[model samples]
Each structure stands twice: as structure tokens, then as C-alpha cells.
Target: MRTEETPLGRKRRARKINRVLAETYPYAVAELDFRNPFELLVATVLSAQTTDVRVNAITPALFAAYPDPLAMSQAAPEALQELIRSTGFFRAKANSLLALSTRIVDEYDGVVPGRLEDLVTLAGVGRKTANVVLGNAFGVPGITVDTHFIRLARRFGWTNETDPVKIEHAVGELFEPSDWTMLSHRVVFHGRRICLARKPACGACPLTTLCPAYGEGETDAAKAAKLLKYELAPGREELLKKMRAGATRAELRTEGYGLQA
Candidate 1:
């Protein structure tokens, strides 16, 4: 994927790679389980330095205790810490959630702001976090440049920029705004399940020919199969078959899928 080409040619190839990913993971989403904007805002903040599984495990309790900005704004620091202890950096995260909740209650009238500009103003919310909230919660198109997105974008020759904002702008130029949110989901899903940072399952990946960094990990199909995670893991065929049969992501979530958490 990292090859010499005209700017237009590179953009064309990038869209093609996105198409392959779209096919590979038809059930792609943010992975975090949140019912509304406030939950998503808090979850995305807690998601830093942790996996979605850990965050999801704790959100239910956290939300049960403090379901909204007004409620969370008054949460006891010690209680919040205990609830989110598994996500790591609990103290810092607790402070963030408390501060942001207070701010939302005071400033936004207990409603999570849907605009990116307003979202970024909250404590612990950056472009990535704001984008997640804007895209998923508000139906606003945004490119979330998380670690997985940055690595895969560079490897796919989509952009040479290292900064998240630069990468977002560069990649955003390649696809329509309508494609931004879904494209982010697809790229992150591929990175999590196949194009792993340390041991990518390149052989099992659909974008092998489109990936410039192919063969950086095990390229043998059988060996690569062991490297897959989540829905692509061994013995997960039924999930894949169901997805192929037009199962909605919500339907899979209801059936006790691992990602439901």
C-alpha cells in the first residue's frame, strides 16, 4: 500500500482498501457499550490506556450509580474510583469524569453537547473522544484517529503524517464525510482482529495485496488463524455465518456475543 502514486491514485487505492474492510467486518462498531451521549463520553474517556472489555465491565455499575451528568456530577470520588478500578488510572479517570460531569451539568444543562467544538472542551475529551461522541451519539460524521487507526492508516499508505489531527485531515480528504465514521469503525475492527500491532494475521486479512506492510507478521494462513481475536477467533464461525446472513449488530449483541460487553 505504501507505494509511489499520484495523489488521485493514492486516494482511489485507499477507498478500495476501505471497501475490503467493509466486507471483512460487516458488524463493525465502536465496541464500547453505551446507551446515550453521556455514557459514550464517559466511556470514551475511561477507554484511554484500557481495552473496551475492561471499560464495558465497569460501565454498568458506574452508570447504575450515576446515570446522568447531574447524578454523576455528585458522585463520591472514592465510589467512582472503586467502580472503574479495573480500567486502570482509576483516580485520574474518576477526577475526569467528575469534572466533566460537573461541567456538563453547570454549562450544558445536564445534556451532553453534540458539537465537536463543545465536546472537546470537556475534561479528558480530545479529538478522538469528541469524534467518537459526535459520530456515534449525534450522527455527525467524524474520523476517530485512535492508535489502531493511526497505525493502519500509515501502513496502508493512506497518509504519512504521524500526528492524529494531520492523519485525520489527510485521510478525511480521501473519503466522503459520510464514510468517515464507518471507515473508522472498519479500520479499527481490522486492526483489533487481524492487523494487530505486534502480530498481524496478514494471511487471514482481506487487504493483503493492498497493505504495504504485509508479511510484517505471520503470513501463513493456518498460523495466522491463531492470531485472530474477537469474532474472527477460532470456533466463532457461527457468528460470522450469522453476520453473513444479515444479522444486525444489535442482534448479535443480544445473542451473548463477546463484543456486547
Candidate 2:
């Protein structure tokens, strides 16, 4: 457990950490593929306990079959179940998706609601899901307290709380509301790429000096570099090399990695 520091000291550390993360992950955005708000909402709901890669793979066919709330709300249960089978929790997810679409079609006139309250009221939608939809789709600012955010927030000394709501409120107080959405992306990006749950790449972390939990992982450069997530292997290294050479995020995207973890 970390000793509580002065509030002002903690804020300073958090600000520096935020800045470093922004620089490191300039192109951090939602990794899930979506053409619009409705697609994003469904994709996010299916993403529970699964990876973005898997969700992405399934969504193309899923969306093609039922492209809108009206269409999706009427989809056959068995068909929907089989369609999303590989995403895990298929039956529950299908039920939620069907119910969610039905509610949108019935209540919101076939459009995904923009407000956080209304979004959360939809089936399978929670605070985290609502925040993701609001921030990415509707331009509303919100903090998404995912597992990555929870872990990194404590490691960075921003908040000691374990509850997602408490962690969201605590960190929300430190940054501007507009920064909340992107802050989530950067922190999640760092968490996935460097500050992994089991073993972090401490020596290779750009924010090591600012991090309170600095020595928790391998400190040797070679070993630390090897600790990066599998997806970040050759691509992340190449991306970093270009970033050092002053590549814009758009340029990096052209070179392949513009998605968030």
C-alpha cells in the first residue's frame, strides 16, 4: 500500500504523468471499429471479458446482418446467438444486444441516446460503456474506469480507492472534464503496453521517473523491452522510432498503429 502524500504533491505527479502519457501515446483512441454510435455501443457491450481484436472480427458480420436498431431488434434469437458465439458470453450478450436494440427502437426512435443517463439505462450498458459511447460517439466528456485505469491510477498515486466509481470521481477531480476521455485512452494505452498487470516493463517505461511504483518490474532494459505486450512487439518499436524522429499521429496511422488498447 502507498502512503498518502499531500494533495498538491499528488496532483503535480499526476499532471506530469498525464503529460508523459500524452506524448507517448499521441494517437490513443477507441480500438473498436465502428461506423457510428450504434455500432460502437453494441461493439463495446460485446467487448466485456473479451479483447477488441475478437470483437472487431465478429462485428463485421454482426453489423452486416442487423445494421440498425430497428433491424437488430427484430433479429432471430438463435441467429444472433450463433453470430456472436465466439465473443464469449454469447447468449447473455445476444440477449443484451437484442434488448438494447429493442429499447433504442422503442424509446429513442431507433437512435442511440446521447446522454449518459439514457445510455446507461439501455440493456447491457453500464457506466463504463456509457462513458465510452459518450466520449467517442457523442463528444461528451467522461472518465472510463476500466481495469487498466483502476490499476494505473493507484500505481500513479492519483487515487487509493478500489471501487470504480470512487476512482472515477477521484481522478475526475484532477483533470479538466475535456481531458477525461483522452486521459482514459492514454492511461489504458500505457497499462496495456508497458504497465501490465502481472509484470510491467518498468525499465522501458517512459514515465518510470514519474511513477511511484517504479521498481515493481524488470529494471534491465533488454528484459524490460521483452515484457511489452505481444501486439506491441515489432510495430510499437517501429512506431516509437518514428515518433522520436518527429512523426505525427496521422503519419503513424499510415504506418499502421492508430488504435488504443
Candidate 3:
């Protein structure tokens, strides 16, 4: 059977997906913990192959020691590496942090540059990191196509490109500039929670009805059940538990249950 393409069909599906995602993840935000542009740059650098939680844990000590670009620039490479050791890629990250800090101190007058091009010129700062700092720290609109965002974009038929830059362009075309930062966070959240890489929980995913990949791997009830069973593994269980607790507390407060009990 040939698939029918209609404007109404596409619009309805898109709207439904957006509405469900917005409602389900009303408070979706960047998980990276940073207070300023410099901190964000450092955190993003440290978070290359590491988890944000690990990066966050390391940043407190690192930031406390250095605090700013000048201080970090002057910091010993060994000292910086020791501070960021837990975040993995310590040697490379330390070098990047030191080099980037020196550039900020000498070139940018100790301020993180707001412009995307200028930000990317810093050592170890790619488009994704630059975008994160620009959008979140400097109030600039830029699309961040990290692994999660990239994976989801491809899965959702937002783009077929594997290159991060291409994916960013494709997404920018789909959504407004104002929604760039928040949209990245939302896609990342959805990718991590429901629309996972290996076995997506399409049945429970808020965007499944809108996703073209939905039910692609499910040919039988038993296979679907097996996939769902794998989704409940210990690591997934822990993540879901934490997310559920946070959501439950927010819901309770919104419903005035917090005041009652």
C-alpha cells in the first residue's frame, strides 16, 4: 500500500507530538550544571565522553580553585588535570581548558565570547560546545546537536544527516530560532528517557505516534514485550526512578498537594 501524504495529516501529527512532549517535559532543561559562560565552556569540554553528573561533581572543585579565566589560565596544568580527573579525558580536557582560558584572558579580556565563531575559535570548543555556551550562558539562540539530539533528530525524521552541523541546520529549519535552546534540551531528554538508541520504548514514548520509526522493530507482541522488559534493566530503572520522583514532586506542588501534606 502507498502512503498518503496530506498537509492536514502532517500538521495534526506534528501538533500532537509537540503538545505531548511539551506537557510531558514541561520543565525540561539542560542537565549541565554551570553558573557562567566560562564555567559552561569548561563543563562542556569536560563532558565530552563523560556524564554531566560527573562533570558537575568535578566542576565545583575546579571552579573553586580557578574561578575565572585569568585564574584558570595561570593554574598549573597538573593541578587542573587533578581537579578534572574524574570527568575522564583528563589530560586532553586539562590542555583545552588551560588553552581556552589563556585565550579568554588574553584575547577576550577574560570574558567568554558570545559570538559563535569567536567561541569556536577557542581550544577544544566545537560548534556544539559553542552553541551550549552561547544559548544557555549568553542568551544567544543556537542549536546544540549533541549525541542525544543527533540520534533523536535522525530517528524522528527531522534529518537524515549524520553530521552534527547538517543536523543542526535541518533542525533550525524545522523550529523557530527562539525555540532552539529549549528544543535541544527537550530532544535530549526524550532521547535519554524514552526514545533510546538500542531499543526505544515507542509504546510509552509521548512522541511515538509522531515518530516514523515507531513500531519498526516490533513485529510481534512477544518481541515488543521483550523489548519493554529490557528497558526495565537496573540502569534504566534507576534513571526512571529519579525522573519519576522529580516529576511526582513537581506535580504535587502544581496540584496543591504539597501544602496539604
Best by TM-score: 1
Q: For candidate 2, what is the lDDT?
A: 0.88
How close is every model to the real structure, measured as TM-score? Answer: 0.94, 0.90, 0.81
Across 1-261, the per-residue lDDT of candidate 3 in tens digits comes to 114635455445544555677776765666777788888899898899977767766677889999999999999999888999888889998999999999999999999999998988999999999999988998899888999888877777666799999989877876668878887777777776666677776766556557888875443544443454322432355444444456543343355332110
Ranking by TM-score: 1, 2, 3
Candidate 3: residue pairs that collide: none
Candidate 1 per-residue lDDT over residues 1-261, each given as its tens digit: 434678998888899998998888877878888999999999999999999878877888889999999999998899999999999999999999999999999999999999988989999999999999999999999999999999999988889999999999999999999999999999998888899998899889898887788889899999999889877888888987887777865677678875521
Better candidate number, 2 or 3, judged by TM-score: 2
Top-lDDT structure, candidate number: 1
Report each candidate's C-alpha RMSD, comma-separated, in the order given: 2.0, 3.2, 6.0
> RMSD of model 2, in Å?
3.2
lDDT for 247 (candidate 1): 80
Model 1 residue 4 CA deviation (Å) reads 2.1
Model 2 CA deviation exceeding 4 Å by range? 1-4, 234-236, 239-261
